[model samples]
Target: MFSDFIELIGAFVLVLAILQISSDRLFFSVKVYALQSFFVALSIFVIGLYSSSNDLYISAFLTLLIKVIIIPFTLFEAIKEMKIKREIETYINITNSLMIISSIIIISFILTRYIDLGGEIISKKIFPISLSIIFVGAFIMVSRKKPITQLIGFLTLENGIMLAATSVTYGMPLIVEIGIFFDVIVGATMATIIIHHINETVDDIDERTVENFEE
Candidate 1:
C-alpha cells in the first residue's frame, strides 16, 4: 500500500513536469514546479516512514523547507521585482513539445527495462518515472527562452535526481543530503541575483536577447 502511494506521487510529479513544459506563462511554470516539489517531499517522507530511516525523514524535511517553500518564494519575489512579462517564449510549438514529452516517457520505460536494480518492485517502477522527469526537465530548459523558465527546469531536474536517489538507495546519508540542499539553495540564490542584474541592464529576461548582446 505504501509503495502504491509512492508510485502515485511519482506519477503526479511526472504530470506536473509535463505541465511545466506545456505552460506558456512563467508564473504558472514556477507554481507547477512548486507543486511538484511538494509531492516529491511527500513521497520522500512516505519512504522514510516505511523504511524507518531517520535520514530520509530529515531529507524530506529539508526538501519541504527549501524546495517547496524557500525556492519558490525567492523566485516569485525575483519575478515581481524584475517586472518582466509573464508570457514565456519557446523554441518549440506546444504540439511538438507534448509529442516529445510522450516520446520521452515511452523511451524511459524501455530503457529502464533492461537495467535491473535489485528485486524491489517499487524501485523498478519509480526508476523510469524519475528518468522521464529528468528528461522532460532538460527539454524544458532547452526549449524555453526565458531565464526564469530555465531556472524552473533546473529545479525540476534536481527534483528528479532527488527522487532517483530515494528510489534507488532508499536515501543517502543525512550529511550528504544536507549538503545537496545547501548547494541548491546557494545556486538558486546566485541565479536569482544574476537574473536581477540581467534585468537591470538588458531590461528583458529572454535568453535570446542576452545571446544577441553577446554577439
Candidate 2:
C-alpha cells in the first residue's frame, strides 16, 4: 500500500517534468517544477513513514522547505524583477522536443530492465520514471534558449537525482542531504545573480546574447 503511494508520487513527478518541457512559458514551467518538487518531497515523506526513519522525515521536510518553497519563491521574485515571460526560442521546436522526450522515456524503461539493483523496493517500482526525469531535465536545458529556463531544467535534474537516490538506497544520510540542500541554495543564488548581470549587459537573458556580447 505504501509502496503504491510512493510509486504514484514518482509518476506524478515524471509527468510534471513532461509538462514543463511541453510548455514554453517560463512562469508556467516554474509552477510545474514546483508541483514536481512537491511530489518528490511527498515521496520522501511517504517512504519515511513506511520505514519509520527519522532521518528520511527530516530530509523530506528540508526538501519541501527548500525545493518547493524557497527555490520557487526565489525564482518567482527573479522573474518579476527581470520582467520576462515566455522563452524566446528553442533549439528544437515543441513537436520535435516532445518526440525526443517520448523516446527518452521509452529508452529509460528499457534500460531499467537490464540494470541490476538488488532488492530495493523503490528501485523495482519507479526507477525508470526517475531516470526519465533526469534525461528530460537535461534535454530541457540544452534545447531552451533562456538562462532562467535552463535554471529550471537544472533544478528538475536535481529532483531526478534525488528520486533516483531514494529509489536505489532509500535516500542518503541526513548530513549529506543537508549539505546538498545548502549547495542547491547557494548554486541557485549564484545562478540568479549571474542571470541578472547577463540581462543587464545584453538586455536579454538568452545565452547566445551573452556569448555574442563577449565577442
lDDT scores for all predictions?
0.85, 0.84
lDDT tens string, model 1, 151-203?
A: 88999999999998886678778888899999999999999998787777774
The C-alpha RMSD in Å for every predicted model, in order, reads 1.8, 2.0
The parts of candidate 1 lying over 4 Å away from their true place are: 119-121, 204-208
Off by over 4 Å in 2: 85-88, 204-215
TM-score of 1: 0.94
lDDT of 2 at 207: 42
> Which residue pairs clash in candidate 2?
none
lDDT tens digits by residue: candidate 2, 66-142: 98999999998988898764454687898899999999899889988877777645647578888899999999888
